[model samples]
Target: MTIRIFRPLRVRDFRLLWSGMTISALGDGIYTVALAWQVYDLSNTPTALSVVGVAWFLPQVASVLLAGVIADRVDRRLLMIFADVLRAIAIGVLGVLSVAGELRLWHVWVLVALYGIGNSFFYPAYTALVPQVVSKELLVEAAALRQFVRPLTMRVAGPALGGAIVAGLGAGAAFLIDAASFGASIAALLLMTARPVIRAEGKTMGSVLGDMRDGVRYVLSQRWLSMTLLAVTFAMIFFLGPVFVLMPFVVKNHLQGGAGGLGLVFAAGGVGALVSSLVMAQRGLPRRPLVVVYVAWALAAFALVGYAEADDLWEAVLVSALSVGALVAGQIVWEALLQRCVPSEYLGRVASVDSFVSSGLVPLSLAITGPIAGALGALVTLRWAGVIAGAILLGFLVVLSAATALQPRPDPGRA
Candidate 1:
């Protein structure tokens, strides 16, 4: 089992892509720390922090469908490279502005919007590209490996290092590091020889919309897929804002912690996620993958309630670790299921719609989280949000459990 966990690494293309993505994930962790702290430091308001989330999500909401279409029509590796180049340039400029002490809230917002746009294009292509590089028998192992590396680098090492850098040097240094990481990712993409599963087929402007509509119809036709997406959308709407917008404030105001403390909290969560990923990589999926996914997600939501009630930094760290561990475990299974079930021809579009729907309400949540926290208090807001999300997820678990569509169908290779 242990040896099998590393099986995906033997594939040259997956290995190179994974290496680049791991480096990129580390930069993302650093960028997240810098962005959150820089916003709070400049404006000293929860609303200001919320604005950053809103700015990033808005462009994603608008551009994701087009991104999905483009991914399906062209070489996904090239699309990812283009996105990385754009992101690298934007972050580089942001680092320069920050170092010059000429940075403003609006400046951050604009650059983040650009970053979000790039992400919108990159993610769908990346998700669809994974199976192309690895054989079907190795899909679960491949996803598990990625889940492991992502948190280990992005969450554990990245945030911890970013925190130290922000404390010792400045956020600008972290941003500069993030910019350089994108170059590594682009190089990896250039080295990949994977071909697109779906080609343009002489695509026209009208056919593009038709393709998107077909994608939507495909999702709707699957009861399990639609229901799972519906549940996730609501859960994200209720959960994401409080966690992202209020956590930094919880560290600074409630716990009297610094950037280093916040970094420690994130790193702890990464450690937990890393452990979960390793376990999943070894154990593989359960008999009922969907059931395990929903139950694990529900546990994660309940853990957030613990986070909201924590009195000190260590308490938050412990709770966050538990939550992240469960979340990552569930996600690994979920990704494997999607890769196995969804047809390769429409995988890019399906994955994009999945992302779009799950994140569709995030901007609204961010917009409201600040005002709600300001009025109700951060702890109260976070606690209640967790409760609501957990309840919703439990309901989803019940529904999915009873649905034959989501039940395990025998896969000779996997089982």
Candidate 2:
């Protein structure tokens, strides 16, 4: 079982891509802690804290569709490398200013905007690039391997390492470490000898806008794809942003903890996710992926209800593990299904459109979360958000069940 899960690593291109992604994802975890602390340090308000996320998510909303078009027209390897370079330079400059004590709240927003643009461009290219390097037989394992390494590095090791660095050295050092990690990914991209095959033969358009519209129509035409996107979009709109904006406060004010404590909580979630990913990797995804995705997500949303009520840091840690573990399990299934089902010609555009729709409201959600937290208090708001999100997810399951029940059944006598 272990051998099967690790089989993707034997492919040279996938191994390189995976290795680079692992390093980069770890850096991302480190950056998450560093960025949160840096923003909070500058202005200790929920509203102020939201600016960084708003900056990050706004570009994702604005340019993701265009990024998809660009990914299809260009070399995906070069596109990813460009994104890494842009993000690295942005963070590198921020790290320099931060360490020198000249950094301010506004600088964080501005620089992270550039980082966000780079981020918005990277994913579509990365998603489309994967299948070009790996065989159909190994694609599922490749996805599983990625899920495994992501939690192992990003969630578990990254946050723990970031928290220690921030505690011992400071957030500036953590920022620099994150900036440096991009170099490993860039090097891997540079070393790849093969030019990936692009499948956009008849899919090209006279204009980028035409391309974007085509992508949207394609997604809309597929009921399974569109339905899955709709479910994730609404659920994330209610859950993701509030959690990101509020969790720090819950750790700080409610639990009386610091960056290290928050990191520990994040790491706990990673540990649980690691276990969940391992099980999926070993056994492979369940036969019914759509069912698994919604069920797992519903359980995750409900787990947050317990999170808001945690009495101490340890209790929070345990709940974090469960909620985040369930989230990872669903994500692994959904992503693997996406790669397997989508035509390669549409993969880049579809990936972008998928991200755009799923995340479209996230910025607004982040923008509102602060004001909501300020009015209702972070824990109260989080608790209510969990209930709403959980109920909505279960509603999706109910609808699916009813539809299945209404389907016509076959009989041997009729045949």
Candidate 3:
């Protein structure tokens, strides 16, 4: 049978969920431009943004295990609603501060921390809920739909809209849009009338840490899944993290521009990523997702190097867009792989592990990127970071494939 990408939308519950999520993503796009500009204005340093990133990421890493546990034990729909409420309050505060002229770097730090906490609860719940909303046969298609909207609406249109808002009403107004989006999302989740299959009934014999340990153990036992996680972990920690954390610096010093310039780069990247997501939706992922992911990373690294070397705005914009396209395409493959291979009962935990590893490295990269750039000069350090990350990703690709060569295919008999 030919694969139908939009098959998941045939379900009423899923249609509502997907539409709400798309609107939320559009708000997120606007928020990104505002947040980046806000961070820069507060400290006049790229390191400041990195610091905000650290504040956001560390809480996510810390809370992911608990988030997974909650997803498994609670009504995931309610949990998601709760998360959206928290985010709405947090972003609303940011909006208030912006209008009051009281927004400071420390305020951004606090807000980011709140946002991260919400994400910790929100992501695992969201991932775990997808399988429940659609049939097993349509899981891949649902995942693809998610991949399409998130990148295209959230990142692509998001940044461009955010740029325009920032240009007109400034970053604060952009944040208000994000707050409103969260409120809208909560309304959507509350209206999800389909009942979800809840897990962890009558099994209250374990500690949270014990549950977390079990989740980690489960991931370790999966041959292909474990390897994919490791590869992604490495890529996020070393390559993608540094590029994003350092790009603002590259924008200001290397590209000779300010907040507007940074917004342009983000917009360019969103454009490229938006196109890539659309392509992935049309053509299901390559069978060798591992190889595809590795190639994307390599291209991404090369693009970062190109960004570092670019002496003009046009060159930087072009490189930024291409690099983002590679990154988003790689993410689609990775996400689909996980959605396909991991069992639904363990999906939340597996996603939690993925979040833990992926997010853990981001703080480290952010913390390190600034100091390294200061010591080695931004472009030189970025170049080295790119080359080293590319080499590591390629090596892991070969090793992981060889290691998993003996693995069996996912059983169609199981959900």
Question: Each model's C-alpha lDDT?
Answer: 0.83, 0.80, 0.77
Task: Report the C-alpha lDDT of model 3 over 317-352, residue by residue, as the tens digit.
Answer: 898889988887877776666666666656778888
Compared to the true structure, candidate 1 yields what TM-score? 0.84
How does candidate 2 score on lDDT? 0.80
| Candidates by TM-score, descending order | 1, 2, 3
User: Per-residue alpha-carbon lDDT of model 1 for 270-292, expressed as tens digits?
Assistant: 88877887788888767788988
- Which pairs of residues collide in model 2? none
- Candidate 1 achieves a global lDDT of 0.83
Q: Tell me the lDDT of model 3 at 338.
A: 65
Q: Order of candidates by lDDT, top first?
A: 1, 2, 3
**Better candidate number, 1 or 3, judged by lDDT:** 1
Pairs that collide in candidate 1 are none
Highest lDDT: give the candidate number.
1
Misplaced by over 4 Å in model 2 are 1-3, 33-49, 98-106, 163-174, 200-203, 245-264, 308-316, 367-384, 398-415
